[model samples]
Target chain A: MVPLSWYLVVAFMLVGLGAYGMIVKKNLIRILIGAEIMGNGVNLALVAFAVYGGAFSFTAQGLIILVISVAAAHTALALVLMLMYNRRYGTVDLSIVQKEEVA
Target chain B: MNWKVKMMQDLQPVLDLFEQFEFFLIAALVLALAYLALEHKDIVYAVFFFGFMASAVAGFFLLLDAPYIAGMQIAVYTGGISALIIFGVLLLPRAQDSSLETFATGRVRTMGLILSGVIMAISGGLALIFPWPETIPEGVPEQSQSLQGLAEWLWQDHGVYIQIIALIILTTLVGAVALLKMEKAEAMSSITGEFGVEAKPSPEPEAETEVVDTEETSEEAAN
Candidate 1:
């Protein structure tokens, strides 16, 4: 069997990559994508820990069901917000908010 | 007979190493696809890579012997969330100049890189340094391995969490529909005063064609 630490290493790396996406990307959609990635990374870590606990594995599986549904809801709502943002500004450039010309 | 016995002993270690190697490749693929998703310039392709990354995550779950979660990952992430993103893209206004607007400034990006790198290093380093058992401990209740056990654990103890999540999903569904149903004119009405002259498009020139956008939404809203 694969050791526990390896999964953790990968999971954290994923979180890091997702963080990069969320921070550097200008588009709202890309930011959302980054958030999704970060969530997945966390989920992987949780599942790993649960597997290690043995008895907790079942609870974790059930928990993942909750997590996945919540994530789906999260994405849908975020996209709706992005749509609103775009329609208001006529663009999704995101940097538009920084400009002093528009209050 | 001695040589044959030695070969059998050697094969066990190799087989174990092969299992570890297989998992390593999945981990590598997940990270690689994640990197691609982050770095890709085009938003659609970035979403595409993100979808693949999620699928790779599902495969990782399978590696951990959680087949049910893996299937759910594929269904929810690869199927549902990806479709939502694509639809969001479709609903987006087409930009006049699209090439250079996707990334932040170099300084901001560099700062992000440093912060996230520090975070990943701390977390992963902690996990690595912590002494964890090499295998699952013995005498674990056998119920953990079965679906019935998972259901019992979830519903019996954690029903509260499940209920809360369901409520959130319900709210989200309602909110998304409400947001989508709102007209563009209404959405921008508050900001209209600030950008009054710029709001309405003049058909005479190609000017502000970027803001003008598709006639479809306006027409649909009229209906």
Candidate 2:
């Protein structure tokens, strides 16, 4: 098997990219995309650990499916929220939060 | 397609070179697509690249010998989430996204770069420092491979989690519907020209000017 650490490296790199996107991107949907990327990184790590720990396809189905399901639900809610924000304010630009200085 | 057996052949390095090569290849694809998704100026195209990145992750899952999970990832992420986002975009008024400036200036990007680098360093260090066992522990229950095994494990061992997730999905569905209805109600009120609605409003100076006008007319009558 490939050493677990190498898989970890890839996972963390993806997460880092996601973090960068979330922090620097001005659009709400882009931030949500960043969150999805981060979730993917986490799922990658979970599967890698499961495989390396010899659970192979087993944990992949059980835990990873649960994770994916949750992510799917979350995506649906987030899209709705984005739609609401867009309809209300006429834009999804997150920079308005900074101008408003909302806590 | 089933080159997993080939992964057993060991190389000179501490890692399995052939397996590493395939995993890294998929990983690279995932990363590149993720980057493109984040950097793309158009939100729709960004969602497009995100779907591709998710497929690339499914390939990574396949490399790890989890074809079932890989299939689910493809189904949920590419088919479901991406479609949801695209439909959400389509629901918007025309040219709504035209105002969106996706990327920040260099200073913000640089700050994000530094912070992300720090996150990488810390997580990587933790991964390296932790005492990872060489093999699966005897204490942990054996979860067999394949869908049948997964069904049993999910229903028998972890059924509560499934129910909880189902509840969450149900709640999200209801909440999303409610929010959409609320938006419609607000739109109706705005269209009917309801006063004190948050939709239509001018600057505070307009309100102050009205108060000043009333006070000046009262003073003129007094004079």
Question: Relative to the true structure, how large is the alpha-carbon lDDT of every model?
Answer: 0.80, 0.80
By TM-score, the best candidate is 1
Models 1 onward score TM values of: 0.78, 0.77
Model 2 TM-score, all chains together: 0.77
Residue B81 Cα positional deviation in candidate 2, in Å, after optimal superposition:
0.7
What's model 2's lDDT at A8? Answer: 88
lDDT per residue as tens, model 2, B67-153: 788899999999999898778766653323555464588999899999999999999887877767644553443445467777787
Best by DockQ: 1
Model 2 C-alpha RMSD to native: 11.7
Residue B24's C-alpha lDDT in candidate 2?
Answer: 67
lDDT, candidate 2, at A27 = 80
**Stretches of model 2 off by over 4 angstroms after superposition:** A56-60, B1-18, B93-102, B129-143, B183-223
